[model samples]
Target: MLAGAPSSHMSSSVSTSQGIFPTSRIGSGESPNSGASSFTQPIADMNENDETDLLSISWNQDYGCFAAGTSHGFRIYNCEPCKETFRRDLKSGGFKIVEMLFRCNILALVGAVANSHYPPNKVLIWDDHQSRCIGEFTFRSDVRGVKLRRDRIVVVLEHKIYVYNFTDLKLLHQIETLANPRGLCCLSHHSNTFVLACPGLHKGHVRVEHFGLNVTKLINAHDSQIACFTLTLDGLLLATASVKGTLIRIFNTMDGSRLQEVRRGVDRAEINSIALSPNVQWLAASSDRGTVHVFSLRVRVSGEDSLTQPNAFQGPALFHQNSSSSLDPLISPNTGANPNSSLSFMRGVLPKYFSSEWSFAQFHLPEYTHFIVAFGSQNSVIIVGMDGSFYRCSFDQVHGGEVVQQEYVRFLKFENRPK
Candidate 1:
């Protein structure tokens, strides 16, 4: 039987007129208290030269919100209602990366190279409640990315990742990886299962660290460099895509076994982001080809059962045993089964293309811009583009075809500079 696709009800359009702070203090650098307020300066009214350039965007631990680092400062937005929660315009400089710790006032910030006050080689731990950086970690090299949990902060450098204790900023551990210019790394947010995934020492390999179990497993995910990958909330499953960008593979993180594979397309493209549904029953991928593909996942990771078991965190048996047997028959409800070529039954007789599993549903965007995708409430997929476009689209889990665009908002609009 096909597991039910998760669903969420989101507003179809975001109201630009609504603001989280007083208009007079929009960019005044004053910290506004949390409460109701009027709309401030809309991006549309800002002068072309004064417009803040978007440097980076990332979703919080849960997909409930996302942070946007800009040339001037950083802002946070709520996902469901699609509203700007708050923003800080710092005079010191702009941030190249802004990572939020859930919905709290704490954020991990990396500055753009142009800013002298906040350099590229340092990570600032900002506490909005205090409106100042409480801690900072300076590195010898430019930081690539930052991941934050309540108890720890993981800073990704070009070839080394540093794990630090969140409270005292003490160095806890370090992992050497391949030359990872992108600073690719992911951490599980669940308290019971502390897992981390990053590129292995060798090309096309992934190093999985189960902190709770004190175990580390290496999986050779692909033949090409890993372009993008995402882990489930509990870190029980991993989905990886290589630079080839045509195929995506799902794996059981505990045993380093491939669970299922889904094809994005035959042509090569850069995969920007891969997101797995909270329930682990669906997967989504976005690419430079301007397409977002949703695939129904066949394997299930029993994350819930592990939470209730007494022996859950015992040695290497932390993960539920059901994960290995979760790969049920491919038969789905309305769709009957995952889409495959008619010659799929002739497996060995034909090429791999005929036997490959393709995406169940797809959504297209403008090919020129880069967009990242994440699964949202109620079977909807949330897409954020580099050009300041935000989209929320829903898909049919059973039929698997075109996704319906329910909401679209240009959260950041820049006027064309005078030539």
Candidate 2:
């Protein structure tokens, strides 16, 4: 049996400071200070008071940037150099959630309850270029989360999820789910594939919808209630963690088949987030245990495997492997193998724990703080904490051990500028 209930929506009431920096593309592997003097003023005021409360933080579809919702408004930051690019401070209200669609000017905003102009039951589609809300969607209950894609807008309520066409805001689909206070839902960002995963009506079950194929598959993802899960950009693979938080299982979304499983630890912990690399070669998970783990994926999507290749059923080479010897450019040949227990060879002779695979690399942080993680370019992991901490670390793919910290910054701190 699981030890506890799944976590609910996370929010922090801590103060934050603002600073401006030059806008640059993420995943460049460049130091934050490499070109400091070229920093430009932010689109919004940088000299605003430092007492703003951080309500939430979410990564963009590509993980190249992140949106931070504050009591004052919301801000977007580039991932690589970790600098604020744009922000909006509203006199009327604050945002509780800000979901970005890549780097475009369109964003889906959910307002904090403290303000009345922007209600918690409404999602406002804001276009930064026009500096106004382009559209809005109202719900009967408070919205739990919002997801944005170029073609669709997903709104998550406590017990339902609504999908809408981006162009005309026409309702496309609606799904009923179990009580999900965390708003646990994920959608494929790939242009060709449209897949959505959310909690099913039963505990420990996941409902996956393949819109293109018009198929729905229910996966018994775990024995306990799911705590966290993530899908690859193509939505071909999914990784899930239960409230137990020790084991993370990966599955093929098309056939509902288990592909791989990795262990986070023996003790129980609250999983904060899970992320899969763009190439579907690596998986990362963060927990309340104050650690982030990266594991290598062994499942290969080959054209020969009819059940595993998403491209065989859909269009384009969604996630196909050329050959057994071929490796993704983002992965090193020596690093893909995760460490297995010596007793693993004894197959079925011992308990599952002895035969499970473990993380290839790990990064430590202060325990008790909520964090979200994502893969950055060049085998680096980007971590953002609810306490306003930002970290960039690289792992020795060849060695498979503790990761090296590349950069660390208190992103939400006050900065003094010359008048």
Q: Choose the strongest candidate by TM-score.
A: 1
| CA deviation > 4 Å runs, candidate 2 | 1-49, 302-334, 414-419
Q: What are the per-residue Cα lDDT tens digits for candidate 2 across 1-419?
A: 11111224321111111111123333232332322322222343333445677889999987888988988778888888888777666666688989987877678889999866888988877655434455677666889989987788888998888887776665678799999999999998767668899999999999999897788999999999988998776666788999999999988787788888899999999999998775566789999999999999776543222333343112124334555223222233534688899999986999888898999999999899889999888658999998778999998876779988989877675435321
Model 2 — which ten-residue stretch has the worst lDDT?
A: 12-21
- Clashing pairs for predicted structure model 2, backbone only: none
Predictions: Cα RMSD each: 11.0, 10.3
The true-versus-predicted C-alpha distance at residue 405 of model 1, in Å, is 0.5
Please write out the lDDT profile of model 1 over residues 108-196, one tens digit for every residue. Answer: 88999877688998887766554445666766789899999878889999888888766556567779899999889999877777899
TM-score of each: 0.84, 0.82
